[model samples]
Target: MALLEVDHLSVTYTPRDQPANRAVHDVSFHLSEGEFVGLLGESGCGKSTLGNAVLRLLSPPAHITGGRVAFDGVDLTEADDEQLRKLRWVDLSTVFQSSMNSLNPVIRVQAQFADTFAAHKVPGDVTERATELLELVALDRRVLRAYPHELSGGMKQRVALALALALRPKLVLLDEPTTGLDVVVQRGILTRLAELRRELGFAVLFISHDLGTVLEMADRVMVMYGGEIVEDRPAAEMLREPRHPYTRGLLGSYADPRLPDVRVSYIPGRPPDLSRTHAGCLFTTRCPHAEDPCRTIHPDLLPDRGGLVRCLVAQENRLPVVTLGSAEAATVLGSHFPATGSLDRPADAADAAPVLTVERVSKRYTSRRGMRTNTVEAVRDASFALRPGRVTALVGQSGSGKSTLARLVTGVERPSSGEVRFTGEGGADVRVDRLRGRALRDYRRHVQMVFQDPFSALNPTRTIAYALSRPLANFAGLRGAAARERTAQLLESVGLSPAGQFLDKLPHQLSGGQRQRVVTARALAPEPRVLIADEPISMLDVSIRAEILELLGDLVRERRLAMLYITHDLLSARLLADEVLVLNQGTLVERGATREVIGSARDDYTRLLLDSIPNPFGKAAGQQTLPST
Candidate 1:
């Protein structure tokens, strides 16, 4: 028997006075012993819902409406609450996305393992089991005495993994386990998990939004769209010949920074609304190959050459299956950039009059640790410039001081040493630290920022119109009807057309892409001369990412605005930046044109960052290339 089998499983969330939303619709799949299956999709495509349903962890308003989830022949849907509780952590377990928040903050790491063991009524020494599991994930026993806050993000995630395997469960479900981590950290976690899986012989269901990571770890790949599994195939086959249009779009949406001069594309429209019932294919709205049959008749999982696909066009052989490396893929490359020649490089922006300059800036923070105080150098002698109509990208790993430098540029924090200067009105160089009262306000109005998380950056309780109007009122002195009108105009500029439709909607009501667009619109409200975007699109979906990148490029070119595009992903830097600055350990290691630095790196640290990217077309799990940098 299969280790885990989900047969025609359906989950629905029924909100009060609203329509019932079928998040997971008739999804059927099975995991054999020790098999690794990757479930991938966009944010709202129900990847998490499916995983939750399998674990029998669905809360109120999110209950299984149909089908069965059988683990080793015992149906989870029919199991009692007490029975299900017993099965978890012993027979089945899960590692959630946010490891830091998932653990109890008030207790040490060791106590958490003891609580799990006590709850499951397992017969073993909790300390011994915890220590063994920690070693399994390559963590030291010293971590047991530390609190969650003391551990790094990667270390916390490893602790969570160790807890999940405390009882040697037959299967484990990982839901976006590596999200928000740096590439190097993400690679380490995945590598360790793969090794443990082989040694322990447990089936894994890895659900993630990152296609490249999924492609790297999964033995078999499944693409979920609008609550349905549209494609299922072996990992190698799926990467080679993706049959469904949605799968093809996902594979082409992201630009791999490690690969030089590669073209990226995105799906045209948004995903379908699950609250409303659809009689046809769930992806018809965004599928480029949708036809009459796709609009009226829903397709079923039909057998193909090496896997199963749920598309009428595929069954009819209307659209040819294209491989990622095929010649015909050039048409699907989407953008109008040249296919062969080297990508455009930024002009000598270093020689131009800089709009904003950071000269030998360094910031130090003194923190109290127990009885002693320690000084941390967040940024050290960092120097860079943002020139007119040019994008200067700041690339670095997490804790490499990219964010500290951003704060220094935006005047949120003062540098302990060195200077931050910007070209003020009337073309005079002004020191940012010396600005006072109204001068400081005016300085802030001209130097705006687009933060990383759009949801947190925006006010959740307030209307979209209110969020945009605040900046206009405070920065431009616009109020009442005038501010409202400008808000509508700003919304239209960001591609959220018919601004009236979204004016009164809350931030939570909008999609990830739309929320990010609103964030971009708010930053542009002041018509700032210099815009600093800190990882603006990293949290967004792959299909939504290209739109944001293209929007930034358009704004910079059309408005002739100087931009400091801060991101850890080199692919995004390559696509949006003119100049690239590499930061490592609070110091600037390399700075040059984006194409030149990425295409031919002279520094080992710079090369390490490039080599760390997970290649979708590369070898399978445990075979990924690694670098210590």
Candidate 2:
């Protein structure tokens, strides 16, 4: 029997005056006992909505208008609040995307677990149970007393996982559990999660935008798009042969950073409009295999003799050609990985004339925890120079001072150390470090920074039109229609279709990838000579990752923007870098041409780093998956 089952489940969200927004529809699926199920899709594609519906956490305006939800033999659709409360922690739980927000910042970590146990009335020593749970996630026992703020993002996420498993629930719903974390942290978490499942024997409904991680952990996989389950199958089999066109489109959207650059096809149209009824295949607008019949008729999701397919093309082919694109992509990358492209040559004296340079920059902050005066060296003795029309990657693990270096270079923070120099495009020697007051403002105009999280970076209260226009109005002094027109042009350039579709929407309304594109477009508003992207693609999925990477590459070649690509992902750094700088413990350990550093990795740390990169092929390829934060 299935551990949990949902039949014809559809969820709708509507404001009092607004049209009904269907978050998920006809999302029928079942999780068998001890099976690991993955719900994979792009952001804003109902992945999170499905996770929320499973937990009955849909807020106001969201109602389960149709469907039946069964946990084992009991129907949850009619369960009372008291019944839900009883089942929640003991039989069902969730580990959210943002663990920082998931935990109560004011409460101690141990106390939160105590609350979980108390709510469930599971009858256990709360501290001991919490400790056991913490051990399961590889967290230390001492973390029990620490407040949410004291822990790192990874630490906090693991703590959240521990709390979710405090009562050893039969089913755990995980939503993008490792989205923002670096490599090492993600592997640690996924490993522990696997071990926990083995020991506890609980089924999981894993939700993520990352296909790689999902393939790594899940027993079964479900693909969702436009409020529906387009495909579902066993993890190993589906990864080997994805039959649905929508699934193929999802996979084909971008080149894997770990692999080489090849011709990638982007989904041409936006997802179907759910407010209006979709009588045809929901993905027909973007499907390359789409024929005349698709738009006129809807597809049913059902189990077939070949496998689970939800498309007419899928029924025709029976088994998809799992294109050995990556192998070809890998072979191309192997050929390209060692050779300097048309842009980047080996670092020599000729390449030393820097476009933007920072020498011995430092930033310090005082400890907030009453250590009686200890300083945090956010950026210490950090020095790197970005060459003209070439990507220089500044890479280090988290807390190794990458973002602080960005803040210092962007002039958002004053340096505590030496100097910054910029050779102006029009050929002026500008000492960025010595610039004071208004001079610093001029320096800021020449160099721009693109942040990682687009939502927090943008002014949420402002519309996309206003936010994009602000940069133009301030930098170029364009007002009214001119600014609006320029904003539309920029949006169109960044791959947001038509531009008008997004202009009036707020930051929250756009998906993560679209929001990121807006951030890039805003940075380009002033047409700055140098662009410093701080872990820009780290938060994105592999599909959208290629888009952003390609965009940056095109921007560098077309606009001659000096690119500073800061990231923790090695393959990304290698693929995007002209010259690579490996930073460890706030010191430059390896610095040279991209090919040189990657092919003949010099430092042990650099070698260790190269060793840690997660391979999409599988662990059998001898690649390590990063720790899940």
Candidate 3:
């Protein structure tokens, strides 16, 4: 018998003034004991909603309209408050998308764990249990004394994971558990989770937008689209032969950085709006092979090749198997979406003068605790040059000084030693470190940064127009109608077309991808010669990532701006960067052409980062063959 069964589940979000939106429509799935099943899809595709619904975690404005969530033979939808209280942590637990949000900021880590144990009336020494749990996630027991703010992102996630497993629940639901983590840290968390599962024998319902991670970890994979389960199959089978076109498109989107050459592509167009009912196939708009009948008749999920698939073409056994990046793949998979730019090293880039130069730059921080002074080196003698029309990728692990370098370059931090120089107007070398007041303000006009989190990077109280216009007025001395016109042009340049439509919209009104574009447009408002983008697309969906990467590349080529691309994703680096700089422990470990550095990495740290990347086609996939349709 299945450990958990979700039958005809439907979740709806009904606002008082707006129409009802069915986030999860008739979704059904089953997970056996000790099995790992992954729910994969783009953002807003209802994967997270379905996961939450199964646990009865949805609150006001969102409710499970219909469906039976049967866990261990108990119908969760019918469970009373008392029953749910006992079931939640004892039989089932969840790790949310953001660990910081899930953890209480005011409470110490030890107290938090103790509260859970005491609330459940577990008979044991809470501290001992907490220590064991932390150890299980590869964390030190001393972390118990620290607050959630004191821990790193990866550590917080591990703590959350430990809390979820405290009661030895039969099933655990992980919602985008490893999202936004560095590859090395992500791999470590996943590895530790796998080991814990093996030891405790708990089932996991892993939900994520990353296709590669799901394919690499999950035993069975279910592809979700338009609030429904479009396809469900073994991970290995899905990796080799995805029956649904949407599933195939997702597979094609992933490009292994270790490869000699890769051609990554995304399905054109965005997902369907769940606010309105659809008569035809949900994915028909995005599928390249969509036919006339697909426009009117909604396809049913039918058995196909040992799994269920909702596609008319696949049901008819007419869909061809084409290797990604081949001529046939382009023809069948709709390569109409422009390429993810190119990695072609520019001939003039080598001869171009340096726009910004860092000479023996180092950053240090001193913190005193209990009359003891400790100094830590964040960046150590880093030297590099940003040339016009070229992208130099700074790749490193989380605490390896990637962001510190960005701060030093953008003049946010003063280097303890050495200096940062930028070529000013009339070939004047400006020392970024000594700039004061007006000079500093003017220097900022020539350098701008696009932060990682677009939502936080933007002011929530402000409209898109205000966000862009402020920079225009401050840096370009444009206001009124001129500022408005320039804002539209910047929006259009970032691929948010019909810029007038987005001008009045608030940051909350736009999607993740759209918000990132707005953030990019605001950065370009100053018309800077150098662009520093720190993990620009790391928070976006895979499909949207291709779009953002393409936009960044186009901007660099069209404007001939020098760019510093800081990221932990090697695959994205391979897709966008011309040159690569590997940082390990605040030290430059490797620097070379993108292809050369990734294809033939010499530094141990560089090789580790590349190896940590989730490879769906690696040995873990095993020997599998695509069945003849």
Candidate 4:
């Protein structure tokens, strides 16, 4: 028997007045012993709901409506509250999206483990288990006594994972476990998770928005849309040839560094409505190959090749590559230059006026541990400038303080000591540090920021309408109807389709990518002169990251918005940036043109980072001794 089998599982959530909201609809899949399966979709397509349903964590107003969820032949769907409580952590464990917040802040980490053990009537040497698990996650045992605040984001996630494995359950469900972490940290955690799976011999249901990570970790993959599994296949076979038009669009939508940037496209619209009753293919509205049949008939999951597809057109028509010819690049890439969008729009010339200038800006913070205060310098005299309509990227290792620089630039925190001069504000120049109150707010209006995780950045309670309107009302003085129409325009501009549906849905209702799109729309609503995107795509999959980047790039060129692209990724910098600044240990190591920096590196630390980027093209990491500049 399979370790876990979810047959035709359906979950629904309902508000007081509205109809039942189907989060998962007739999704069926099974995992064998020690096997791995990935549930892939955009943010709102019900992957997490499926994970929650399997774990029996779906709260009031949301419940399993249909089908059987069997774990090792015991019906989990029918399992009562007490049965679920006993089964969880001991028999089936789940690492939730917000697992970092799972720990009790008042209780010590070791005590938390002790509670779990005591409840289970298992051996209570919690320290040993905690130490072993910490070692497994590459964390020091000293963290056992520390609270969650003491741990870094990556460290907290590791601790959460260790707790999930404390019982060594037969099944482990991971929901976007590596969502907000940087690439290096993400890779490390995934490797550890893979090791845990092998060591414990547990079945995995890994849910992620990033297709690349899913393809890397999963044995089999399923593409979900509007609460249904639209496609299913072996991860490799699916990546090789996805049959569903929605699946094809999803695969093509995001730019994976492993693949070349060309031949990429996006789904023209947002996902389907879960609350509205529909008798069609869930993805028909956004699908390019949708026919009359698609809108009228609901397709069933039937055998295709290696797995299954749930679209009549997909069953009949072979999937297309959805290649972008020269015209596609012209409308997008040409905006970077003068000829495509506007004639006098200006190319990235050396003579362009510099907007925001940073000269030797560095920040440091001291940690007090028993009176021995160790000063940790975050930024090391990092210097760069945003030119007319060009992108300047900050590339570095995790703690090198790309975020610190962003905070400094946006006046979130004053730098420890350094100069940041504004040169070409049409004679409206002001030092970033000295700018106070009104000046700071004015400066902020000129510069907007986009965060990594699309979901959390947005307010879950508010509709997208409210979110996109806040900036316009606060920054631009537009309110009421003015704000609403402007919100629609901003939504369309950011590529969230229809714009009508998004205005009503809450943040949790959207997918990770779409929530991010709404965030971008909010940032753009203020009509800022500078857009500071901090690791914007680090939380996204390979497929969707490029789409968001392209959106930003398009805005930069077409709207002439100066962009500060801050990230730890060298490859993304190469693709999106005109200039790149390399930071190491809170210090600026090098700055040059993107092509120049990537091609000829004079500094060892810069080269280390450039080399660190996984060569998606599969080239050997070059060995050229770089000097400490």
Candidate 5:
């Protein structure tokens, strides 16, 4: 018998004075006892809605319009409040996307555990139970004394997981559990979760947008699209032969850095708006092999290759085999670069001089608590050069000083020792740290930065035109009609076409990918010689991530701009960077060509980063389990 089952589930959100948005449409699935079922999809595809609806956790504005959520033979949709209260936490629980926000900020971890036990009237010693829970997640008991704010992101996530499993629930629903965590930390959390699942024998409904992670940890994978389940199959089979095009696209978007050749592509176009009704296939607009019937006839989920797939082409066994590096993929990606080839520097790039140089730079911070002063080194004697038309990737885990190094290079913070030099007019070496007022402004004109979070980087109240035009006017000395024209061109360069349409739209009006393009456009408005992209695509969807990477690569090649690509994602580093530098605790651990370093890493830290990457292909694809650190 199944542990959980959803029959024809549908969820809708109807805001006051707004049309009903059907977020989850006729979704159905089943989870067996101890089974790890992954729900995969892009953002806004109803993965979370389905998970919440299953547990009857949806609040106002969202309601389960129709469905039967059967958990352990109990119909959750028909259950009363009292019945739900008795079942929740004891039979089922959840770990939300943001662990920090999920936890009470003012409450100590110990108190939070006590509250759960007290509310449930569970007969047990709170301290002893809490200690046992913490140990299960590999966290120390001392964490019980700390508040939510005192713990790190990974620790908070683990705490949330511990809370979810406190009562030894039969099933747990985890939504994007490791989304924002660093690779190593994410791997540790997942490994620990897998170990606990084995020991406790609890079923999991893991909902996430990350295809690689889902494929790595899931026993069975269900791909969601357009508020519906498009594919449901075993993880290994789905990885080997995905029947649905959307599933294939998601898989193709991930590239293994350890491979000799790495290529990644994305599906074109955005997801359909759920508020509006659709007649045909929701993915038709983005589907490469979309046909006539696909435009008007909606497909139903039918058995295909031992799994359910919602596609006419797959039903007819007529789906084309399009490789990631094929022409069809290139057309779908809209990429200007070659489908498969060496990401070598252009022939003319060899003789270009260094645009920026860091000479044994170091950064330190001193914080005083009461009468005691403590000093910490954020970066130590780091040396590198950014040459024109070349991308120098700085790869490291969080708190490894990657961002601090970016700040030091862009003159945000002065180095405690040594110097940062930029090539100025007439071949002069300008000392970045020594620059003042006007000189500082001039230096900023040559060096521009694209921040990590596009949503936060952009101004909420300002229009796209204002964001781009201000930079143009200030740095390029352009005004009036000239600034407007320049802004349009900037948008076009970043691939946000029909610039007039986006010009008047606010940041919130654009999709994450569009907002990032606008951010990139604003960065290029200054016509900077050097571009520092600090985890620019970390917050974007997998498909959009490929687009941003391709855009950055195109800009570097065409404009001969030197780029510093700082990120924890080694696969992206492999895809875009010509050279790679590994950082460990602010220290330079390894440096070499991208392929050589990632494929045959020397440093333990570098290898650890590579190992942390989720391998969808599993053991057959040479993926080894991440070692315990």
Candidate 6:
């Protein structure tokens, strides 16, 4: 018997003010014993809703309207509350999308495990079982005594995985388990899960927006769009010859780091609104190959070659190649997008003048725990100069002093021993630490920062207008109608058109892309000469990323602003930066023109970082493929 099966599943949400939203429309799939299946799609495509429906965890305004979910010959939809209570952890379990924050902060790791055991009524020594599970996930036993905050992000996720597998369930549902994690840590977690599945023989239903990781980890892949499954096939076959246009578009969204200088493309239009019904295909608006019938007839999943696809054009073998050409993408990126060949090397600019300069700066932190005192060097004699109309990228892994350096430059913290100096067009150089009163205020006005995680950076309760106007009122001394006029202009500059529409809306009302744009607009409100953006696009979706990068590059060139782009992804650094500075363990290891440093690196650490990026394309020669479960 199949381990899990869903036949004609459907879900809908009925909000009080708005019309009913049909999230999942007649979605159907199955997972066999010991099989690893991947569910791939973009955000708001009902991937998480389907997963939640299968687990019977959907809360109101959302509910499963119709479906038959059978697990091991038992219909879960018809199961009683008592039966569900017994079946939950014993036969089925789930690891959620944000499992890193799932643990209770007040409890120790082992105590949380004990609670799980008590609820499930599992018979065993709780402490020993916890230790064994930790070992299975490649974590040390010491983590059992620590709180959730004490553990790193990856460690917390591993703990969640261990907890889910505590009862040795027959099947596991994993939803976006590795999203937002570093590539190296993501690979490690997936590898560990694969090993455990092989040893324990449990089926898996993995849901993610990350296609590259899915291609590497899953045996079979299913593509979802507008709450419906569009294509289903073996992982290799799907990547090699994807029939559905939606599938191909997703594949093109990610750029393979192995193929340096490659241009990636994304679907342009927004997803369909679920509250309003569609007559034809849900993806027709963004489909490059969309035609006559696609506008009037809704396609159904039918056999095409060896797999099943829902596109009429695919069944007739008329779909064009989805891989976009460089010139085509460039035109789509618009003529105004900065070209690599058009700009001079930032370090060699003829009119270069230092906006901010750091000279032999170092910072150290001293911490005392119990009876031991330890001193850690965050930055070790790092020196660099920021020139106007230039972008210099500081590339490093986490804990390599990237954030520390940013704080030093932003005046959040002073260096322990060295000097940070700033010079204007004709003004004498001013030491940062010596500034006070009006001098300090003036310096802050000229220097501003755009932070990572735009969602957290903005106040959720405040309107967008309030957030943007604060800096203008405090620094530029504009208020009331004057401040409002400038706010609208700032919003327009960042590509958020019709500023009046967004001014009154709260931060939560806007999309991720729009929220980041508002954050960028807020930073630009003070007319700062220097902007420090730290991993600004890391949390955004693939399609929205290029737009934000283009916006930043345009602002830098048009305003003659000095930009410090801090990131761990070398691909992005190469795309936006003219100069690259490589840092490792608080020390500057390499610095040169962007192309030279990326193409021919002398440092082994830099090479390792470049190589660690996940290749979304097919496997390279001598690459180790994960063994199928």
Q: Give candidate 5's error at residue 295 in angstroms.
A: 0.8
lDDT of 1 by residue, 1-629 (tens): 88898999999999888899989999999899889899999998999999988988789899899999999888899999888887888888999897557999889999998898888787777778899989999999999999999988989999999999988998999999989888778878888888788888898999998877787778899999999999999987877777888787776764455455556677767788899978889888877778988898999988887899999998888776465544334335443221221144333445678889999999999999899999999999988888877889999999999999988888888899999999988999899966778878788988999989997998889999999999998888999999999999999988899999999999989998899999999999999999999999989997778778878887787777889988888877888888899999899999998888998989998887887776665542224443211
Backbone clash numbers for all candidates listed: 0, 11, 0, 9, 0, 0
Clashing pairs in 3: none
lDDT of residue 264 for candidate 6: 48
lDDT of 2 by residue, 1-629 (tens): 88999999999888799788888987788888888888988766888877887788888888888998888777888888888888887789888888657798899998888877776676868788888888888988999999999999899999988888877789999998877877777777788898788878998999998776786677778888888888888765665556777666555532333333323333444566678877789888777678888898888886754457788767766433554334442333223112222233222332646788898877778776665878876776878887667888987789877877787777777777778788875878887767779878877777988888877888889999999988898889999999999999999888777999999999988767788999999999988989999988877655556557767777776777788889887777765677788888777888987767777787998876665554444432324443321
Question: Which pairs of residues clash in candidate 6, taking residues 3 or more apart in a chain or in different chains?
Answer: none
Error (Å) of candidate 6 at residue 5 is 0.9
Candidate 2 residue spans exceeding 4 A from truth = 122-124, 253-266, 318-320, 323-326, 329-352, 366-371, 460-465, 480-512, 599-604, 607-614, 619-629
Candidate 5 worst ten-residue window by lDDT: 333-342
Per-residue alpha-carbon lDDT of candidate 3 for residues 361-432, written as tens digits (9 for 90 to 100): 999999999989999999999999999888899999999999999988888888999999999999999999
Candidate 1 TM-score, C-alpha based: 0.95
Against the true structure, candidate 6 reaches a TM-score of: 0.91
- TM-score, one value per model: 0.95, 0.89, 0.95, 0.84, 0.94, 0.91
Better candidate by TM-score, 1 or 2? 1
Better of 4 and 6 by lDDT: 6
Give the Cα lDDT of each candidate: 0.84, 0.76, 0.86, 0.75, 0.86, 0.82
Residue 463 local lDDT, model 3: 95
Better of 2 and 4 by TM-score: 2
Total clashes for model 5:
0
